[model samples]
Target: MTGIGAKALQTRWFVRSPIPLFRAGLGFVFGGRLLLLQHLGRTSGQPRYVALETVERPATDRIIIASGFGAKAQWYRNLQADPHCRVWIGFDRNRAAIARTLTREESAAVLSRYRREHPKAYAQLASVIEEATELSIDDIPYVELHLS
Candidate 1:
């Protein structure tokens, strides 16, 4: 599959650009669709931030996000080392939270619902993820962030 290389994904200016907005407490501009995840780096133990699309908001305090780059993603790896983190969602900034990797069954269910509700987005995301990781959407890693 034709996919973006690691460098292309990491160096994309636009991907990291919104981070400033979230840091500036203007994250609400993205509505509830995207969130800024502030997690501790696995090696450095320093704060790292990444903006990710919300695959599902199952509850007021729970959100689902996927790792399109598979387990190799730095953010996903950091969350694995330390699940504790913070979230900046619409109108909410720097809220304490915890991250959890979903089981295969849980990921399947969430992706199913996401596909149903957001067919267009799911189609595009699935394509990019599949191309990048050479894995089916169901095989991608999904993380649930629970706010405190």
Candidate 2:
């Protein structure tokens, strides 16, 4: 977070470089710690993809992700426009899913679990997110992808 900023977070090449690997069905390389979300564009209705860090996988069929950029993130907005989507995580690809924004209380619980389960990662993420968005972890929006 020392040198990372809002501009760095918004950099297309830096953030989206992993998407190609996910699309190629190599998501397992991420060790279940990241996922590729395939959603429809809110206005264009075209497929859009994003590689997001996995905050938690509470169940085999569910993955929780934090919108570090908050509710205004493009992927978050698109999911809100249409919850239907597909997910690629670990060795799984193209699994149908529904995205839902967790309530504040639910997000808090998930964040707590994430922090406990992955203290090092949580600390690094919290720092970068705080620097980039100027928002605390509790204020960030969390979304759950319920896979089918």
The weakest ten consecutive residues by lDDT in model 2 span 1-10
Residue 80 C-alpha lDDT in model 2? 95
Candidate 1 wrongly placed segments (more than 4 Å): 1-10
TM-score, every prediction: 0.91, 0.93
Residues 64-117, candidate 1: write the lDDT tens digits: 999987898899999999999999999999999999999999999998998899
- Against the correct fold, how does model 1 do in TM-score? 0.91
Highest TM-score model number: 2
- Looking at model 2, residue 146 earns an lDDT score of 98
Q: Write the per-residue lDDT of candidate 2 for residues 1-148, one digit (tens) a residue.
A: 4457455676889889889999988999999988999999999999999999898888999999989988889999999999999999999999999999999999989988888988987887787788778889889999999999
Look at candidate 2 and tell me the lDDT of residue 90: 96
The residue pairs in collision within model 2 are: none
Among these predicted structures, which one has the highest lDDT? 2
